[model samples]
Target: MSKVVMYVSGFCPYCAMAEKLLRARGVAEIEKIRIDLQPEQRAEMMQRTGQRTVPQIYIGQTHVGGYDDLSKLDRQGELAKLLEDL
Candidate 1:
């Protein structure tokens, strides 16, 4: 629905989980930035999201935090609405 970007590491379980959830929610394209491969991407992610987490997710211009936060929004049934806005 929107442009999805995530900062991920190869071995991050949360990254995997977040990716699964997004796919389940009908996100077709995800721009994944591997912070482990590109260390400078971590700096860019931190500066953009103000977090150093493995799965820093952005839906359009909205910072959706990490896996847990994404789950919370999904559970609350707010994620679809957010995606619609995107």
Candidate 2:
């Protein structure tokens, strides 16, 4: 599986959901960047993703957007392909 990184806040429900889904998809580890703890990372997250939202996820180097986008990819059967290690 590919590396999973998520930019998240402490109280974000979507972040938890995204993580749960990722775990279900065989992602053993998720590198969670807690923007709630590191405020400066919020600016970095927005700068990189162009969205000021919790749970900005990345599968390896590919930006996977938020929980909805991740769920969509899973629903469409693309997430599995994306998670496959090269």
Worst 10 residues of 1 by lDDT: 1-10
lDDT values of the candidates?
0.90, 0.92
Which digits, one per residue and each the tens of the lDDT, describe model 2 over residues 29-58?
899999999999999999999999989999
TM-score of every model?
Answer: 0.94, 0.95
- RMSD per candidate (Å) reads 1.7, 1.9
Most lDDT-accurate candidate: 2
lDDT of 1 by residue, 1-86 (tens): 33998899999999999999999999889999999999999999889888988898988888999999999999999899877776
Q: Supply every candidate's count of residue pairs whose N, Cα or C atoms clash at under 3 angstroms.
A: 0, 0
Which regions of candidate 2 fall more than 4 Å away from where they truly are? Answer: none
Candidate 2 lDDT (Cα, 0 to 1): 0.92
Give the runs in model 1 whose Cα sits over 4 Å from its true position. Answer: none
